[model samples]
Target: MDGETALDALQNLTSAAGTNYSIDKNSDLGDMYFNMTNYVGDTLKMMCMMRSHHMLTDVVLQAGSEQFHAHKLVLASASPYFKAMFTGGLKECDMSHVKLQGVCPTTLARILQFMYTGIIRVTEVTVCQLLPAATMFQVPDIINACCVFLERQLDPSNVIGIANFAEQHGCKELHEKANQFIEQHFTQICQEEEFFQLSAMQLVALVKKDALNVQDEQDVYQAVLQWVKYDEENRRPKMEHILQAVRCQYLTPAFLSKQMKSCDLLKKLPQCRKYLAQIFKDMTLHKKPCVKERTPNTPRVIYIAGGYLRYSLDILEAFNADDKTWTQLAKLTVPRSGLGGAFLKGMFYAVGGRNNAPGSSYDSDWVDRYHPVLDQWRPCSPMTTPRNRVGVAVMDGYLYAVGGSSGSDYHSSVERYEPDEDRWTLVRPMQYKRLGVGVAVVNRMLYAMGGYDGINRLNSAESYHPENDEWTPISPMHVARSGAGVATLNNCVYVVGGYDGSKQLNSVECYDTEKDTWEFRAPIRISRSALSLTVLDGKLYAMGGYDGTSFLSIVEVYDPTKDVWEEGEPLTSGRSGHASAVSFHQCVIHCDQHEHSLSTESSLGWCSTRPSSTLSALAGSALNGAVPEPRTSGVGAVSNSLSAPGRGLPDGSGPSLPYGP
Candidate 1:
């Protein structure tokens, strides 16, 4: 049962069996077994055969001459590790679990030397053989010993083998350690000529993992270019591979310029110039004027629709020109609704809404798609969960739906849908649950703005980056509100009217993404929640919604440049809960009239019939009587803040007045 007693008994058995003992002469077993060197070799070979038979046959031999004889047979043909293990005085190691049975005798002997003396002599051939044996034996110290011996031997010629070994062993840390060693010692291996010899897949993996330093990246770029320039037949397919690597690394402008110069060197190659141009086309950042003069007779109407309403559809529309005529595009199929919608490429998507009842309904799953070119609507894939008042936007051609309310419960789940694939994949949930949220996209990033989180309205904003599939907090809005319409105009997001927890608001706030700040602007003429705001012809327009008691027909325009709001012509009919879109020449409004019909006498009675004079009278009143003294209380309070170049009216006409009631 004791270690020393077990070894002494095994040695006695091997010595009595006429086995050479010199194999164990220099080991601890010899010192413990009374200097049995006379039988060391024979004892070692006998133990090796016994171990091999035990490993292959799963049989245990009695601790006597019979076991010693079986081990001798195994040692004659066993692997070096096994031979080393047997001769190194390992009298009783459990050999039944040995995995590598094909190792050679000489290799096994060296392993035995290491096992006995804790020193391994590694050469090119033995290094490979010992590494696997060390791992198989579960001897970490020996494995590290092998690694140290191999580290000094690594050069440009052997880096590929080291990398392969590291990968095979699933030792990422070791792989990195080996890679660093190779990078330091074998610079020529990463040179242009040498690097080009690597497979494209390997190059891509290296760049993607950011495994290369600046010097290595430059070397790789140069080598890839050289191959493409001089060895066209072999490197033609590698052009795309190189470009992908460059993009992943986000090479500096200087490096890109160098790449461009190298591209010129491949001028004679087929489609080389075209390929280079395609890689740079509209992908790199470009600087240009924000607004360009519109060509004469060009149509610039943009349409937006889809949200929730109570008992009817609530569509909001805004026009772009001086004509501030807000129209009801269409009503929803139901009413008492709060929902989310997005414009993806050319198709407009609307989804999710809740009713007045405490619970959400499957009716929220109604998904409508509108094509601008054909001016029509069709059904598309519905969301997995019937949520109300969700945040939706498109980034990188994928649509993301953020937190919303399912029934009365608030959810923080986020889902992404790919239209081309017609599939939705769940993503990491947001930190907060929100409903009636505002969503916008800027610089390819999606922003979820102010919304209600059930308990109170939210002013905090968060942005999601698809590259990492993560969200980061941004500047919060000045005031918390839900059902606020949001739109990106001139690279800044404008949060229009929405209902605060207490009341509907007309206050407009603009968020500067670059500055990460928010500033108040001209409030719309009417305070409304669940209204829609849109940009047309470079102007911000607030369209129809309920003021709280009844649906509104008034439309207002905010000149961001001037920081002033002016009333415009009203919708043709007095109906709220409608969707709006910028049409060819006007703001096309759609009214959801499932509950309230346009033919209803009461609806017709509330329609505004005032002429254009209504605008002039209101302007005159605002400019003279209602205009506040230069105190910090009214429009004049921030007069100095209105420093933008005044909006140039159509045909250079002055600001037009609204027709009188």
Candidate 2:
């Protein structure tokens, strides 16, 4: 009949059937159907409108000069603080007007709006005030929103205050993120006034961390001195406690001499002078004094995989940058050079490469996974194509293999591996075949750059989008380079030293993905090719490679902000065609009785090349004849047996320390 009559009929049927119906449409159990798509939104909006008009408002929340009218049931359901006040045996349960202490009127108004509308605006002006009120009221969503906002706003100038605030408010994740920012920007943060405001213990705690991203230990010393100078009269008395954070052993002899001669503070403290004297004496005697704690160069262990020195080598060496020491790990399953290495989900994967022996054509399609906790290796699914000098990266939980050669011919094909499924599948190929390519991932896009085609060394580059399975060309380099070391930092992709057609080139280039442009950066001192590059603690470590005339053991570190390069300790020996990955594991100098051997075969039908005695020999060379220590070998054994430097073992089996974090 009419629209109103039809609507009345449906409502009558619905009222007879009840609010939630179970009618069978096919059986024609009911003649009417009803639904409200925006029922929740409408009901909440009506409640908000009623409160705004002060209609049937049951309670008044007073904060300073401001007051808000709200329903007790709505407020109680939205926040635990209000729920406890209304439902628990609190006096406010019966009170019509409740006054809130320690809350700003404006912030209280925002909280009331969020409680009614499920939305709130957090700005720089309001966040500081709103966070505490939200935390006090136990509104988790607003608390998280405030934390996320603060995390994004962190910078060198304000990070210290943000970190302190996060700690005070018990925001664990935000505090950790802010602390990480402090460590990453320590050099810049030292120049800020907020850093000078830190307490002595807080200053000591920041500087003592091995992960502090200072290019030179001298910076750390200067930072501590500056902190003390900020309030010399009061802080001078605490100098001894703060100075412990400076690794005196790492300061250069020249810097120490300069400071001792010019600084009046060093002249006043006998203990500081004595400590400096002892360090100088140790330096003169060529004795590296042991720091009680294991403070490595970076917090993570840098694992150098197979490489070619004279011939292809299977040696796996772990380098601790802080102590400038190397410890030999178990030998690789195969002798592989020109391989690609990466860490995915706490495991290190060594990808395709060739056994570069003279007169050999043994290119490999293997993928070996190392369990950091177990200190053992197991094979994953091999790639569909054999690759040497392959460029590899991980993005979106999948490992990607870029262009490489197969000994006889170069390839333009690319493949992706799924770790959980143990499957390898081919994706779109690149525009040109390349060997000695440098591949990196930035903003989830994989980039392949600088490799040798059959006829010439190529300066071209391309990027792959996994979502569309497509490859797009990008800007070419200034000159052709093959075997360049590539890494990404601060959304910029850097390509380091590689070989041109005539000679080894030390020129470096950085590409900004946002701008799609390239610029020259400070190059390594040594001209090299086939070097391994990885980022650790906000610095780029360019490991051993070949310098055309000879295999080189040089390790140069790049500070991007300063645009300068500094030489770190060299590798144990000259190497080329090596691979590097940062892992959270450290290895003991000696093997345990229950150590898992590399001889075991995986279900995918891959096993170690052979049980080599060369591993022991290499271990002897790396570690100076230290006696073996016994450890129970398993994942659980790691936490119990991994001792810090100078900490005695639980069973009193050995006194020597392991070489990892």
- Tens-place lDDT per residue, model 1, 463-518, is 87655668889988989887777888887899988877667788899999888899
Q: What is candidate 1's local distance difference test score? A: 0.54
Which candidate number maximizes TM-score?
A: 2
- Can you give the lDDT of residue 432 in candidate 1? 75
TM-score of 2: 0.47
Candidate 2, residues 23-140, lDDT tens digits: the string is 3353565565546544566567667766876767889999998899999998998899999999998999999999999998889999989988899897776787888899899999
State the C-alpha lDDT per candidate. 0.54, 0.74
Give candidate 1 regions above 4 Å deviation: 1-298, 302-310, 314-336, 355-363, 372-375, 574-661
TM-score of each: 0.44, 0.47
- Residue 654 of model 1 has an lDDT of 10
Highest-scoring model, lDDT: 2
Model 2: lDDT of residue 213? 57
